[model samples]
Target: MANNIFEKSITDSLINRVNQLTPTTPNQWGKMNVAQMLAHCNVTYEMTYENKHPKPNAFVKFMLKLFAKSTVVGSKPYKKNGQTAPQFIVKDAKDFGVEKERLVQYLKKTQELGEKHFHNRESHSFGRLTKEEWSAMFHKHLEHHLRQFGV
Candidate 1:
């Protein structure tokens, strides 16, 4: 796995990748535009640090625990056009700039907090996570979406 995938440098890399994408950038898979992809990437962080969304029900948590957690936190890369949590589905159009800035800010905050802050932290649905698990969740999700947009 890549090192410090949640660090400021990683965030900067993501910012650079995202910046390289124009509004006209085409996707390699799925139906999202670059803006929507950015928005989709933001949802993971949103689920972590914000109270905007409710926690999944017990059954949903069971489903994620039994089925999704391994794939999400494993070393293997996600399959293209993979399934996602429902909260992550972005149906509305997004502004590339707006989502870009928001994602940057979120990344900055996460980096500033450092791995110690997130190590074994309580996740909304997955319960406690090791730093590597957290990193996997963060890095893999972004890479998956970026690949989707052909970045």
Candidate 2:
């Protein structure tokens, strides 16, 4: 979004935008509450860090390659009501404070590690990523969800 995509200033600004949202704020698009949206955002980093979720099978991987990869790593922004990972679909509301703090911690951890640390990082599903691709995936996904919740 900004010239310095991975700079603390940009990440901090996104955090601020997330903090600006309240529980009562209506979504400009999408079904998730603000807290759920934050949790949804955290899933990307969780996928990168934690090994809790299983990797997709060959067929599923092929499908993601053909359909999901472009939307995830490409320059175009995600549409407001587009498809989401099954684990990310929180039907009920979430505790706002918990989700917010967790996401902030994830962001801080990621930034502290920086690009080179992630340049050859093994992704749970995608194998490995270049620093720039990691930056694109992180920034674009967060921007998409933040815009959805009107933050």
Candidate 3:
């Protein structure tokens, strides 16, 4: 089973992994620099908590549910150097400090909100998800990226 992001212990563990990264941390693979990777990771939380990205049209949402939802929220880990969503591609430079702080804050907020807050919540992309699906989506992505930086 995957770690539950809504639990403080798991959240703290993830935070500690984030804290292990520095501005110049080298990636084990992939193109993103440390800061860009952090910013890319922030996109997930931004979709959830903020209206930064436009919601997909009904057809797109349906396709996402059919094809991407399981891969995203399933216990299986993501392969490295996989195709990234357009919105998640961080091409421009980003401030390392700002992006890192934003990610940490988002993780803390998610944990504080607890599992009940996320149960059957309408995800920005995947429509309604159970608490477990939400936790897997949050935890698996962070875990994959943190591992990418060798944290």
Candidate 4:
């Protein structure tokens, strides 16, 4: 089974991995620097908690649900250097300290909200999802990127 992001232990473990990183940490694959990667990861939470990105139109949302939902919320790991969603592409430099703190806070907020808050939650892109789907999506993406930076 996948790690549950709603669990404090798992959330702490993920934060520890984030704490292990430094600004100069090298990626084993992919184009993003450590700070950029951190910012990119934060985009997921931004979509959930903030009104930063525009919600997709009906057709695009439908397509995302049909095609991308499984790959995103499923247990399988992401491929290295895979295509990133447009909203997640971080092109400019980000402050390492700022991005790291934001990521940690987002993780903590998610954990504090707990599984009940996320059960049948409507995702910004993938529409409604169960707690397990939300957990898998959050855990998998963080793990994949942390592994990318060799943390």
TM-score of each: 0.92, 0.89, 0.98, 0.99
Kindly list the per-residue Cα lDDT of model 2 for residues 41-126, writing each as its tens digit. Answer: 88888888898678888788778767877677778887768888786677877888888898888888888888878886766556
Native-to-model Cα distance after best TM-score fit, residue 112 in candidate 3, in Å: 0.2
Off-target runs (Cα >4 Å) in candidate 4 are none
The lDDT of each candidate is: 0.84, 0.78, 0.95, 0.96
Per-model root-mean-square deviation over C-alphas: 1.5, 1.9, 0.7, 0.6
Give per-residue CA lDDT, model 3, range 13-97, as digits (tens): 9999999999999999999999999999999999999998999999999999999999999988999999878999998999999
Candidate 1 minimal-lDDT segment of 10 residues? 1-10
Could you tell me which residue pairs clash in candidate 1? none
As a TM-score, model 4 comes out at 0.99
The TM-score obtained by model 3 is 0.98
**1-151 per-residue lDDT for model 1 (tens digits):** 3757667778788768877887788889887888898898888988898998899888988888889899998889998877877888998999888898888787778878878999999888888899989888888888888778877
Which residue ranges in model 1 land beyond 4 Å of their true spot? none
Pick the winner on lDDT between candidates 3 and 4: 4
- Candidate 4: tens digits of C-alpha lDDT, residues 1-151: 4699999999999999999999999999999999999999999999999999999999999999999999999988999989878999999989999999999999999999999999998999999999999999999999999999998
